[model samples]
Target: MSEKLRDQLVGAWKLHSYVEIPVDGSEPFYPMGEKPMGIIMYTPDGYMSAQLMKPGRAPFAVNDFYEGTLEEYKAAGSTYIAYTGPFKVNEQNRTLTHSMFISLFPNWMGQTQPRVVSIEGDVLTLGTASPISSKGKTVNSKLVWHRAQPE
Candidate 1:
């Protein structure tokens, strides 16, 4: 039998990328030397959490020279967005919908969005709805989560 979506996602995975797609078909958001990274952990008790580890400085285009040291960047941890709620899969659409009753992002505190999740071998890809930044632009963030192997 094919593995259930829930079963495939029940584990700890690291983030690979976090992109922002522009609404006007302009250049999508890509970090400078952008090594977008993060982590996601889904529990058996209908609980899920995620954290995004991003580069602190781009190629000194806007903010002059890179001020922070490499050690600082490495030490400057990532932000997290977690929630505890129910999750269901729509096999027909190949989509996984998560109903987050509580979330770290205040906006998602009481909202649910249909997301696309695909698992190929050990890689888990997740696509979310258009995320609007403070400037009100629609962007699709593609987050790749790699399964963490037990040591």
Candidate 2:
């Protein structure tokens, strides 16, 4: 990992936006809601983990399947997901791969996802390409992160 990337990612980040685009080039917005939150912390020991939260209220709006309507799932309050695993930066590929040993994202369980990240000052944009292309189209999810302020 380049020192540059390390310096930019060492701290924590807060979620700003989350969007899932369909293979048909249609835009579907997913809500992190008013208090959607996330935290990414990188350690000097080369360990990394991230946690993301979505405000609990209505269905995801886009995919009704992810709507955890069960009383238990709803009483769970705001839905929170997290992953703790190994991470690597391939400067040559301009990508970062996170091999999540643990993930709450059902689809991401035991999956390693490579995310392309762009950083500018305190803003970071994170996204990944879709594996299943449809009609020569592609889908992707993008989430914006803002660097946390130092206490």
Please give the RMSD to the true structure for each candidate, in Å.
7.1, 6.5
lDDT of 2 by residue, 1-151 (tens): 3456755677778888766666665755464555567887777556678888776544443465566557646544336668888877776666777788877756677788888788888998888745433224466777788988878
Error of 2 at 136 (Å): 18
Which candidate number has the best lDDT? 2
> lDDT values of the candidates?
0.68, 0.70
lDDT (C-alpha) at residue 136 in model 2: 45
RMSD of 2: 6.5
Which regions in candidate 2 have their CA more than 4 angstroms from the true location? 1-3, 56-70, 74-78, 131-138
Where in model 1 is the C-alpha error above 4 Å?
31-33, 55-84, 129-135
The true-versus-predicted C-alpha distance at residue 132 of model 2, in Å, is 7.0
Model 1 RMSD in angstroms: 7.1
Report, for all candidates in order, the number of backbone clashes. 1, 0
Candidate 2: C-alpha lDDT: 0.70
